[model samples]
Target: MKNLLIGTAVLAMTAGAALAQDVVRLGTEGAYPPYNFLDDNGEVAGFERFLGDELCKRAELTCEWVTNDWDSIIPNLVSGNYDAIIAGMSITPEREEVVAFTQNYTPPSPSSYVGTSDGIDPTTAVIAAQTGTIRAAHVSTMEGATLVEFPSPDETVAAVMGGEADLTLADKDFLIPAVEESGGALVFVGDDIPLGGGIGMAFRQSDPELRDKFDAAVQSMKDDGTLNEMILEHLGANSPTF
Candidate 1:
């Protein structure tokens, strides 16, 4: 549902670059639908799954998928559990301090405020955001808003639906699917807030060589318009492409 993540602050952990191997493991939080998530078949399936597969194909690398919780995804990567993270992770200063990011695969999409018809005043309303995300960081800065943090994007939305929060802030792309599927249960309120940089693949900083390989593949996809095409197919024609 986000590049919005859930976690505590972490210190950067360094490791040696992955040695040449037969298969490169790709890590993702297999819970955020439309980006990466388990399908009805119980296999990883979604936009990032397809994108990651295409990237592996173009880079001529043997790859496999590994699911991880959002809170520990980065740490796992640092511990060498996976070669890279293709989850919907935004490139941010705090995150950058811990891991290296590829050139953005998706440009920064709009962040939306979703709530009932009742207008929410940032000055006093209770707001829910996923922990460790830019949205949570934003809400924390509000002068008077009561901030509630959850471990996943779904939990943040649940907080609003369950009446624990007055409203929630999250990716517009993720919320649109819910709003349309909800049949009027949710509606957009307030102006769209654009937060952080675009979504990118994350890797250990020591793996710049590996990062370079994927970066070239991403650039090729962008150059041939394949990246934007995938974005349209998954996120919709109206969604802005890189």
Candidate 2:
């Protein structure tokens, strides 16, 4: 899960302003795998792709996928570039003030620290996190730790690998594969830190009807056990379910 305060420049639209549009655009950051990413053919693919498609079908809405950079994903949604944000965005009070969020699609996930070795103390180490993420905010508040931010998640991992930072904090799911493939170069350090409420679809505050539709669709998936199955399939067996 991740969080960042909304900027002041965004102005909310009136109710129903975007809901009347014919095609609903689902925005996502195509870089985060398992959640959402680009396939070899450059199409959006992964857990969210499947989930969003099913949601559209269940809601009886014609939808299209749109990829946006992670940092600007929310702003673009607010700017009407898309109708909804299905990026692995965490539910946080700071963000809720700007955009309306549907019921969460995924439960709270733990954030972990990945480093070159096991003995390093994350509390005082130079920690790297993607800019605008909850992990970065958490690191900044640690009394002795130094927070280094990068524009992308991949660069956060690279910082630790290159010795630019003592550790990188990110979603446990996102780091697990990287650590596994590192061949012992990277290991999890410190306790797993839980952050944010959960993952959800975000819509403009004015688009309550559209938000409600997706919320019902998400609830339908949960009620039928399909969401849980998809969670286990894409997020590993240990992943939390509805």
- The top-ranked prediction according to TM-score is 2
lDDT of 1 by residue, 1-242 (tens): 12222211221233334537788899999888788889888899999999999998988888999999888788788767888999999889888877889999999988888877547765688998887778888889998898899888888888888899988888888888877886788788889898989999998777777788889999999999999999999988777897
Q: Each candidate's root-mean-square deviation in Å? A: 4.2, 2.7
For candidate 1, the lDDT comes to 0.83
lDDT of 2 by residue, 68-91 (tens): 988888778777789999988889
Q: Which residue pairs of candidate 1 clash? A: none
Off by over 4 Å in 1: 1-16
- In order, candidate lDDTs are 0.83, 0.89
Pairs of colliding residues, candidate 2? none
Q: Would you estimate the TM-scores of all the predictions?
A: 0.91, 0.94
lDDT of 2: 0.89
* TM-score, cand. 1 vs. native: 0.91
